[model samples]
Target: AQSVTQLDSHVSVSEGTPVLLRCNYSSSYSPSLFWYVQHPNKGLQLLLKYTSAATLVKGINGFEAEFKKSETSFHLTKPSAHMSDAAEYFCVVSLLTGTASKLTFGTGTRLQVTL
Candidate 1:
């Protein structure tokens, strides 16, 4: 069985500071891991993905995650948080399940940016 776990439901940051969000996952095979950001009432945009390749993966909008096989964790990070980064971030796991490709998402983490 494949599964994913997101550690935080919400995060708050001041503008121009760094951002950090945590995630963990479990899978039978070397699964694909992704971090996606969604604007309000908008579709999910892929931020990054790990497909049994590099351990440290970079994504758009200055976001990056390190795939830790030993720890089974993929935590997203950025050097600075912009006001535009104030959105809901979702940790997603994509895997195959019996004739269907599916995505199991975390509850979601809302990032609040303050001045």
Candidate 2:
């Protein structure tokens, strides 16, 4: 079984500031982790992903996450925050079950960006 936990329910930041969103996971086997962002009325966008490849993964809009197997964590970070970055972020953990993988989404963290 695999599960994800978003440590923060809400995060507020000013424009140009660094952003950090914490996440932790538990899995019985090697897992695939992902960070997704969703705007108020839009579809989910992949921020970054950690499969079996690199430990540090980078994605769109200068976002990145490091898969830490020792800590069971995959935390998301951005060098600078933009107003457009204000959205809900979800940390997801997925594992192979039979012939397919099943995803389990974490409780989302809502980011509030201010000018």
Q: How many clashes (backbone atoms < 3 Å, residues ≥3 apart in a chain or on different chains) does model 1 have?
A: 0
Estimated TM-score for each candidate? 0.93, 0.96
lDDT of 1 by residue, 6-115 (tens): 89888999999999999999888887889999999999999998888889999999999999989999999999999999889998888887988688888888999899
**Weakest 10 consecutive residues of candidate 2 by summed lDDT:** 94-103
| lDDT string, candidate 2, 3-66, tens digits | 9999999999999999999999999888899999999889999888899899999999999999
lDDT of 1: 0.90
* Best model number under TM-score: 2
For model 1, give the 10-residue run with minimal summed lDDT: 99-108
Cα deviation in Å at residue 5, candidate 2? 0.8
| lDDT, model 2, position 28 | 89
Q: Any runs in candidate 2 off by more than 4 Å, and if so which?
A: none
